[model samples]
Target: MFSTYLFFFLSTVALISAVMVLLSKKPIHGVLYLTLTFFTLAGHYILLNAQFLAVVHIIVYAGAIMVLFLFTVMLLNLNIEGEFQKSTLMKFVAAIAGGMLFLVLIGTLKSFDVATVGNPELTQIGLVKNLGKTLYSEYLMPFELSSILFLSAMVGAVMLGKTTKK
Candidate 1:
């Protein structure tokens, strides 16, 4: 019961922050709101017993990605004077489209079956130990291949980044 309430609390905060990310006038405020949304998502992952995922979510999204976003926003020097103003007709159309999307989402949620998604008892699949074991034992070949692929991609990126003499 308590977990359910906590889940709802985190979900509500996430939704609000996500909306704020879209509604915020300043780019920096939107980035901050996006970070808050990511934190709430990490909270939800923790509530779901996916601690590893939660930590990664915070590290990758709230930490690295948010920093990159903030730097970009700062460097861009966004201001309202250069902002493109939306026409009244465009705003009305956007509102109607948003309303329709919201109705579709509500209908989808109403039709979702809770019983089909029940959590299994004593599940530890999301834990780092189990994940490492599975990755190293069962999916070792694909994992190693992906690592090599990523390494090659990094090398290619470095080569491209190097300036060639004219």
Candidate 2:
């Protein structure tokens, strides 16, 4: 009963913050809303007992990604409200695409069934070793690739932000 209540509360917060992120006028405010959304999402992940995912979500999205967004917003010195108006055609197309994407995602998640295993008491060896093993073994390539991607993105953003003249 409490779990269901907590789930609904957190989910509502997440959804509302997500909408605010989209509807916000200022990019900085939008980034703040997105950060809140990520925080509430991490809370939901914790409620679901996915501790690793919760921590990783916080670290990646709320901590690192949001900081990068804030830095970009500050660096860009963007003003002038960025033309808040959208054309009707663009809205219609966006609505259609969003609906299709939602349907596809629902269909994909229909196969998911949450079945909890008996709570095996996790020891010190459970977390760090397990995570390290997966990171170094199964996902090593993708992990290395992600590091390279992040490095390249940092370099690219620096290059783009630099002013040049002929």
Candidate 3:
């Protein structure tokens, strides 16, 4: 009962914040809404009994990614007034496309037979260790490569901001 109530509350907050993220004119406000969305999603992960995933979700999305977005917004000093789009046609088209997407997703899910859930055998090991083993063994190379890519992007952003005129 408590979990159900918490899930409903968190989900509503997450959805509202996500919508606000798209609607907020200030880039910083949008980034903050995005961080709220991430934190709520991490709460949902905890409700699902995936504590390790909850921590990682918070660390990755809220702590790292949203902070990066906030930094970029501040670095550019993005103004709400300068970023307004005056295209009603584009807005209408986006609304239609989003509605179609939601309909298609609901239809697809209603037609599917969900897989049966089974009890997981943890083998008496901590979840963090298990997750780390899986990540490092099965997905190490791609993970490291992505980290390098992010590092390169950081360097590029810094260089572009600094190296302008001769």
Candidate 4:
């Protein structure tokens, strides 16, 4: 009962923050709203008993990514006078697109089996131990491949960062 209420509260905050991220005129405000949205998503992960995911979400999105976004926004030097105003036609088109997306989401929700109950035995699925076991066992190949991909990306970044002689 309490969980349900908490979930709804968190969800409401997330939705509001997400909307604020888009609606905010100032870039810094938008970044702050986006950070709030990320925090609320972390709250949702906590409510789902996925502590690992919650921690990672906060660390990656709210912490590192939000900092990067803030830096980018600040470096862009977006002045109020230099801001671009949206035309009436663009606003109307955006509203129509938003409505269509809402309708699609509602249709998807209706197709889901809301009455289905989760398996109580699988409660530990979100824990670090189980996650490690699954990754090392069931998803070993994909995990290793992703690690290799990251290594290659790091190498490429280092190569690009190096200053070559003229």
Candidate 5:
């Protein structure tokens, strides 16, 4: 009973924050809403007993990624007054595309077999030890490549920040 209420509360907050992220005019407000959405998602992960994922989600997304997003927005100095208004035709096209995507998602979800419960024994798959083993074994190459990519991105950012001599 408590779990159901908690799930509903979290889901409502997540959905509301997600919508606010899209509807917010200010970039900062949007970023804040996105962070709220991330927090609610992490709560959902915790409720599902995926504590490792919840921690990672809070750290990587709510902590690091949101900071990056806010920094980028500030660096760009975006303002509502400076932005151009979207054309009516562009808005119509976007609405139609969004509706189509929503329909497709609903169809995909409906096709899933809801009667089957996942194996209870497999719940430990989300534990840190299991995750570390999988990451170091099956996904080692991809992980290393991602680290290298991040390193290159940092180097590029540093190079871009350097002043050019006349």
Candidate 6:
């Protein structure tokens, strides 16, 4: 009963923050809303017994990524006066596209079979030790590849920054 209420509360906050992120006039406010959304998602992860995921989400997204977004917004000095308003036609098209995507997502989720999704006795799958073992044994290559991809992205960002220095 308590968990149900908690879930609803967190989900509502998450949804509201996500909408605020999009609707916020200032870039910093949008970033703050995005951070709130991430925190709520981490709360969901905690409720789902994914402690590792919740911690990582808080650390990586709410901590590091949000700081990066805040810094970027500050550096760019984006303000209402410097920004151009979107045309009504463009806004209408974007709304239509967003609605279509939301409908597609709902349809796909409705077709999904939750019963056959995972092993019935795999409750310990979210534990850090089990996750580490699985990552090292079965998903090692993909994990290493992701690290390499991040490294390349960092290098690209540095190169871009260097070019802009002049």
Candidate with the larger TM-score of 3 and 4: 4
Please write out the lDDT profile of model 3 over residues 64-124, one tens digit for every residue: 8888788777788775553668598998899899999999999999889888575333232
Instruction: TM-score for candidate 1, please give it.
Output: 0.79
Spell out the clash pairs found in candidate 6: none
Candidate 5 or 6, higher lDDT? 5
Per-residue CA lDDT of model 5 for 1-166, tens digit only, reads 7877989999999999998887777878999999999999999988887778999999999999999899888888874542666888997899899999999999998998678678533588878898889999999999999999999999998999899999
- Stretches off by above 4 angstroms in model 2 are 104-126
Q: Quick one: ranking by lDDT, best first?
A: 5, 6, 4, 1, 2, 3
lDDT of 2 at 26: 86
TM-score of candidate 5 to 2 decimals: 0.83
Off by over 4 Å in 1: 79-82, 112-117, 145-166
lDDT of 2 at 22: 78
User: How does each model score on lDDT?
Assistant: 0.84, 0.83, 0.82, 0.84, 0.88, 0.86
Q: Write the per-residue lDDT of candidate 6 for residues 1-62, one digit (tens) a residue.
A: 78789899999999999988878888788889999999999988878777778899999998
**C-alpha TM-scores of all predictions:** 0.79, 0.71, 0.80, 0.83, 0.83, 0.85
Query: Which candidate leads the pack in TM-score?
Result: 6
- Please give the range of 10 consecutive residues that has the lowest summed lDDT in model 4: 73-82
lDDT of residue 157 for candidate 1: 73
lDDT of 1 by residue, 10-129 (tens): 999999998887788877888888988899899888887777888989999988889978877777777344277688899789989999999999999999865756583256887899
Query: Where does candidate 6 stray beyond 4 Å?
Result: 111-113, 116-122, 164-166
Superposed Cα deviation of residue 59, candidate 6 (Å)? 1.2
**Model 1: how far is 92 from its true place, Å?**
3.0
Candidate 2: tens digits of C-alpha lDDT, residues 28-83: 99999999999999987777566677788999999999998999888887534756
Give one clash count per candidate, in the order shown: 0, 0, 0, 0, 0, 0
Per-residue CA lDDT of candidate 4, range 1-166, in tens? 7878988999999999888877888878888988888888998887887877889889989888888788777777763542787897998899899999999999999998687578532588788788889989999999899999989988997898699999
